[model samples]
Target: MKNSDQTFSLQDISPKGLERSRKLTHLISSEIGATRQQVIPFDRFMSLALYADSLGYYVAGQEIFGAKGDFVTAPESGDLFGFCIAEQCAEILDENDVAITEFGAGTGALADTIIRYFDGKISVDNFNYSIIEPSPHLSQRQKIRLSKINSRLADKIKWYTTCPSEGFFGVAIANEVFDAMPAKRFTIQRGEIKELGVAYDGENFIWEIIECSVIPELIRDQMSNYPEGYTTEHVETQGIWFEQFKKFMKRGILLVADYGYVNQDFFHLDRCDGTLRCYFKHHLNDNPFFAVGLQDITTSVNFSYLAECALSAGFAVDGFTSQAKFLIGNKLGDHIATLSVGDSVDAYRVAQEAKRLILPSQMGESFKFMACSYRLEKNMSGFADNERFRLG
Candidate 1:
């Protein structure tokens, strides 16, 4: 756990933030009260904390990306990440009437960068860029930022609250998206599985144990071989989400980039505490009860489980590799080569960003890229080297 001591202080919160947090807490408490057990599953708690009507973290109109937000994503670092992704998209884009749908387009930075890079480069006549953004606040921000593009590129952008059930073909990108989806938490105690739920204590929310009978059989199969008091998360929603894609998507690839691990590492005996984490103003901690609506809660993805979902959805595992390898194979060095040595300041800036992106000690190994395709013929160039195996 990084920054375990980064606890939240009520005195440090602004009056407006404090008010919002209180309102959201009250809302959640009211819902819990309505329940017969006066408790709710952790996934339900997470959904309300992060995606409730108007008071949730995402839809509450808060600064949520880049330096001013709770955390910075790859696109916020620099255009290099987007440029590399754009190159990969260009390579996979085959049909004439194809489109690109990016799930959770945070700040629209990647969309802007990719579209700018694709201008005149993608020879497809009917190229469209669709963004499936759930938050109206973030959608407005994306519109403002993306509106600056030229008319030709600007016309290619569209927004939706959900993936179109009609489906399309081309590509789907989800960068740091699945980590935010609500996940169920459970623990093993005395050789018995128990659910970890949320309950209101009049003052704050606290953990409550429940029967594990409610957990699905699929999740139960994975909970074995763990010692007592071992806690972990399960995001069954990932598979459900994949099923939606399988039904709607005609034929295309889904690209996912997030910080996570394979099943062996994720469920290792040493990992007793699991990967659930909270972020507030760049600070990280294991506690999720503090500053409820003001903090960002996330759990590391189980890549092996994700791969299984892809396979069950009829999508072949096109590739899986570390972000470092994906970027290198996708020509990250080509972007570095464009830098002019004469301009030391500009060259240094790009070099620093590249280092942060691909260095082993930085975002490189922590983050991974997985591509699942349906009816795609060729392998993705970005994951040609060092393709991972033993995925579920």
Candidate 2:
């Protein structure tokens, strides 16, 4: 396994940092083609930049989440977010012989929080929990955190670098994972489709157009009506990876939560720049070329495409809603109520953190939740009232 001796921090940027970026840039160029053949699809560049074994962003031992990291996910926001998810997981686990599989378990904060919520009830003897993480560095970090916080539960959770196999039953989840996967950036030009790729200009990385597999049939049909100059993006890897995750489920629900929009809004004419961005030290901006493997590169998910893909992959679309709505509907209020009369300091701190999660200006509206079920035929509490968005 690839392990780093130290975590990469923006505060640590130096001449050595430029050299690291230079090395990864050259590695990416080599992975795609020679500099003379400069054009490579955005996804290929992204894969190398973010997931290239020990040198990629995620596996390079970078502090990529929370206050000290590049960005803060819901779990890093506080324990309340995980509590809300745990409330739902509690229900899912009430069933007999089920395991929880999580993809991209960042920092293991959510897993730790959930285990605390469940107390000593969930054990490792039967392998009731598993995490699917390809980044050796992140997996090692997660192991250390889980072991430190709750060592006994560490054995209960198994880590797999690949998707689990067929005939498994459990709750499958991915928190902000789909967006992190490589995405192909494309734009409409002169009413024809063109793909955006990366190229090296001997000195710096540049964007170039390239020929790739046509956009998926589902996306093509959706974009046919858009005007020229329209720009948007899609994650081909997301669909394929979800299909692999779907394979192991004889019956269970896959809850995917990320920031994105439906087809209409995602490919809207005015969204010409697409939703690609790089995160470094909490600074959100475009230009993945800035830090190479030092920053987080992600795109807004296309939930419309996601919904269609789940159906095509042979799963039922269980529910869809904004994160705030899902959390509110799933008993976030109830959890907050329990904290309402706690110690003044703790209560106030908890309330403030909760606000950031549900407020419109925060993660509430921008981040969306999608639940797909395989063979399971029951409604989940998270989608109880605010499930206005559902598959036809």
Candidate 3:
């Protein structure tokens, strides 16, 4: 997956890709047709569209990262992002026997960057990298990419289809991961909360407002505050995910980096349509039903809700801040300085990447960094003087 300099539109999809999408559509249509109510919850639909067996988007053996793919992640932009994260890990794992467990290791770019950055900083015997990736297609890509690194670094890398059953100490990184989790879409209709579901209309998938029989406790109180037809998302599975994470993390930190906002900004009154978005090629759209399993569907995270889940799961809310501040706090400037003394062309490239990472109009302010710890007392370096746990 090479870096993409040009913007990609939906027109780039090939005939083969369309056929794969059609197969996935048929599979989803069949499942919805068999449902008693002729509709499935929005989260269920999203899960099927993105994670249903071999036909799902992530498992369909298609490149989904970098310029030629749907969208580019921060790590894909450059290595500075990974370098900063590696610095944070180094701070927390100081002289300790710990492994870095990364979730949804896309293309293994970040893993490769972090592992290589740790070459002289941490001893190989004290450091290991474990990837918990579910998509076999992506797993293959990661394996191929990481194998090119030094044999010693490659030997320290491990792969898992699920979280490890045994407990270990270290850091857990989830970069742009939680946003892909299936989220329940809800809207207020006739003064009551109703769930938006997906229904097959014989030709295309359509929206069906089903009665929300049991309101989620997290949003029950705010249900009445929204105006009529106000739509938003709620993720109840975060607590369950934390439960699983806690099992393997005997004493460590879970670092989450993604685009999100605090509760007040997340469910703001003016923002009615919610944060659900779909990416086809590089073009963005509000409709998730457009490409079926061929596109990426995601929703912005609610950090406040995530904090509630962490507290319930016995984890301490250690720190929270924007990605820009976190990176700056973690010595992004030092990297830029070092690179500036290198080849002139390389310095110019690093400058462009740094702007994209720290500029407010780019991913800087939009993305957030959150740290949740379990039985660990040390504060992470990325949040030094920039910690905003109160906002979380």
Candidate 4:
């Protein structure tokens, strides 16, 4: 579909445009059963943000990374991040005999970088590579990018529509994947925390904080520990993903890198607005009602909650740290110094960008790394011994 048919343009932000947005909002609210007096629950809100037909961001085919995209990811920073990750993957493969599966392989940039790194660093004859990408557009892109490497290695790259079952041993990596899962939003009013529900407001779309008195006992049980007046957002799909992960991997390492905080940090009084965001053409848009399905909507992951979920699913926590500490622990500086020896300025520029990715002020501090092991007996490689930190 053309951008004009689905997304809001500059003109769409005007009075008439606002009217159009209202109409669209009304349509969505009616579909989701939201009301104007209440806030639409976060999970339903996220469903609209991510999967609202062709209008949803991920389904809309908007440019998502690089200068032309909505935002830049670490893989787009350069090959170094992928190379370093590949080094870690090699360590995992060295210790266990299993294949490598990467989830949500956006643009296949990371896969290309990883394949190149593996080709140069290890013998490909012994290992298999797989990618679980639900987006056909990205899967096609990955196929094209991986073609530059040896065809034999490229052939080892398998694609799965969903995560595999019965568990395989190896490394499973997800970069910026969990944050995209649809989440439920709630707010505290009159000292009662209520779920925000979506509904039509006749002229426009509006939110309603409906009393979820009929919510499943299991879900209610999970929320029993929430303190009074503690309004927060929850990714209802997170636990489902964790269960899938456990079923898919018998014994291997699971690496996840994303921007999020622990429970105490995320649920503090200052975080009432939650971490919802929309990105379009490298710009951040706070109003989800404006763009409909054209912008990427995401919220920060709650790492502490994620860790607990993983543990409940039978995975042992390996390590958790900021990207900066993780890279420094893995000796990123040495890699930069080695790459800088080349005469090409392009190579040097790439190295500099890689440095920026790991710098404290940029993605380094904001992004975090978490590793979980399932049935692995040995310590996973990549970081110095002293760099390891407890998740709790």
Candidate 5:
């Protein structure tokens, strides 16, 4: 939020209105095994706070996943974004007849774009899509959106609360999904590392240092070089999730795009605080404890871990590149040209959105694209122009 241009009022943090704050607080304490004053690890607190049934941020009746929600995804930004992705997806599925499984399929706009593009071209009977969404509210919204776009396409798309039990083939995509997984927060304190946690003081939640244990080797490797007082976060969820997701894919590609860094860049020595952040309305706040369930709390991903996880889980690391390069390489120019901007105002707006998506100082450079393939060819349009290092 500090570096972002967007702003939101303190009042808007209450997504379900401030009335539900008590219910959220009560649910967190009950689900996380917290006594009246006992502390819970930050990761545990985050998991429970963001995902605890109907009481959590995503499920408990609030407008999320759009401009009306806390933040906007690239798909929602414009149809151009999803069209570019569909271009890549279409190329992958040209010969291979398979299902496209999308994790965190918010608003189903990407699916709409894919459907619109391949409507008459691809046989609807051969093509299928499954959205892995847990939130009933969001799923309902997706149904409405998909049906609005095209009822036939909606019929082809199925909603799954869990991964398909049978082995499947095709591409899997999760846009900005990994960053939402709960991460363990730790700080280098007095030459020793301490885990950051949360405790309720009857009136409010406060930060606390929970007992330390044998840290995950991944965390230790990165934190060892940081100076004392340096704070950071790490996640094992993507690796764990990949183990399950890959089971559904006998052969396909996994495309992950989110703002993240390689391990080396993630734990930069000069970074005093890791990339943990909260989004309420459009405003950014570093404190996850601020609005609890109402605000979205997330940390930047460590992409290096993802590649390692994919390899260990039997995926071949295919391509890794910046969002800008990926877009440029994947015919962003073509997609932009397809837009019909008649008026100067609309043209100017389109230009601004493209600039934000492709500019180095904006979302483009900060977000990265990683492709992990399973029994599929590695060379693809998304990474054709990934060679940014050679520019200098």
Candidate 6:
């Protein structure tokens, strides 16, 4: 195919982009010799997708929420989603003064709602707020929104460039964070599954499937689950993330909300093309090569692997459920009940979106909720009877 489009492609990299790509190319060629010219590992591709200096989609200053951004997350559903999460957080706080550390908090919408909810339920002195955001652009946006809140609550808010220090205790929450991690994609050629890698292709970056000799043996061993002829892919970064989570969390809850499925369901024979997707201006694009650094790239999470990693990291699997089940079980219905007393139109609109968030056909069933903890004896209140909860 002709690579003539200048809308957004490898050509858009400009002078600085070419220099960076040349440096990366030299680094790869030196490490792996000429074979590196044909294929670069999936992890490297992920780095480009997310953190390629200025061109990376997440690293760049692009709007990433609501109808205008690349994609919409549950938090974009508005205060209803935030209120539901705050309700659960309040229960966890109980009598202790705890800090709420949110990962990849986009636009601080959720944080704003959380602060409001906590303010209404308890004294502001009882809470401390912190957000871990990597993008300088997004962090500035968060500061702008957060400044509108009372200075007392706003002052309590802090930002971290990386994860918090080890042995931290409190609630660690992430909304749609795990899905953004770089995932390794694989395809079955002949009878052997090979990883897809990126290369310079002399003119521009291109993908090539090659043997995965560099991946850790433990991760490579998991490929045994695939059928003899079936091709599969895995998120190699998920394991690394769990280890990081274990190191930071000494005793507290780790709540992750994202779109994913169990291993069996995720790698079924029907899913040949894999879960890789690109989003630009609210439109889903399958070709990751098209947008380069201007679009959002994501894949579904593997809950089974996450559960196993958490267990190995000494975390007790408190609960595994859908976002819908967790929200309803935690009393989203109760929140809805209160909506009728106010502006009925706005309340109804919020209620409708809330339903879409939790319904199986929409995001509810597709999105999952997984929680793990250390030193906590009781089960997570929000996920109780999670398996039995039906999608509405």
Q: Give the per-residue lDDT digits (tens) of candidate 4, residues 177-200.
A: 998888776655665556766555
lDDT of each: 0.86, 0.78, 0.86, 0.70, 0.78, 0.72
Between prediction 1 and prediction 2, the one with superior TM-score is: 1
Judging by TM-score, tell me the better candidate of 4 and 6. Answer: 6
Superior by lDDT: candidate 4 or candidate 6: 6
What lDDT tens digits, residue by residue, belong to model 2 across residues 1-392?
A: 11112243445676775677778977886755664456888888888889987778899886788778788899987788888887777676553454788889989988887777766565445336788899999899898888887546556788989985646687888999889889887767677778888887776778877765477665577677667766667788766866776777778888888998887778666776778888877776677877799888899988878887788789988788889988887689878877667688878988998899989899888988888888887667888764536333
**lDDT of each residue in 54-130, candidate 1, tens digit only:** 89999998887777888989899878899899888878886465478999998999998888787775554667999
Q: How far is candidate 2 from the true structure (C-alpha RMSD, Å)?
A: 4.9
Error of 2 at 282 (Å): 1.1
Q: For every model shown, what is its TM-score relative to the native structure?
A: 0.95, 0.91, 0.95, 0.84, 0.92, 0.86
lDDT of 6: 0.72
Better of 5 and 6 by lDDT: 5
> What is the C-alpha RMSD, rounded to one decimal, of candidate 1?
1.9
Across residues 111-223, which tens digit of lDDT does each residue of candidate 6 receive?
98888777655556867888899888888899999989874666789898787784677888989888888877776566566777776545456667666455445335655
**Model 1: how far is 90 from its true place, Å?**
1.0
Least lDDT summed over 10 consecutive residues: which range in candidate 2?
1-10
Report the Cα lDDT for residue 380, model 6.
63
Worst lDDT 10-window in candidate 3: 1-10
- Sort by TM-score, top down from the best: 1, 3, 5, 2, 6, 4
lDDT of 5 by residue, 1-392 (tens): 13443355556544446666668887666644545437787888888667778767777767776678889878887776777777788778764374688888877888888778767766667788889988787788888888887536557888998787988788888898898899988888888788887877776777788874557788877787668888998786777888998788898898898998887688788667888888887778787766667878899988888778888899987788889888887788877766745687767777777888888898899988888889999568888866423211
| Residue 121, candidate 6: alpha-carbon lDDT | 57
Off-target runs (Cα >4 Å) in candidate 4 are 1-9, 12-30, 33-40, 95-98, 213-231, 381-390
| Model 3 misplaced stretches (Cα beyond 4 Å) | 1-12, 96-98, 386-389
Output the lDDT of residue 195, model 6.
Answer: 72
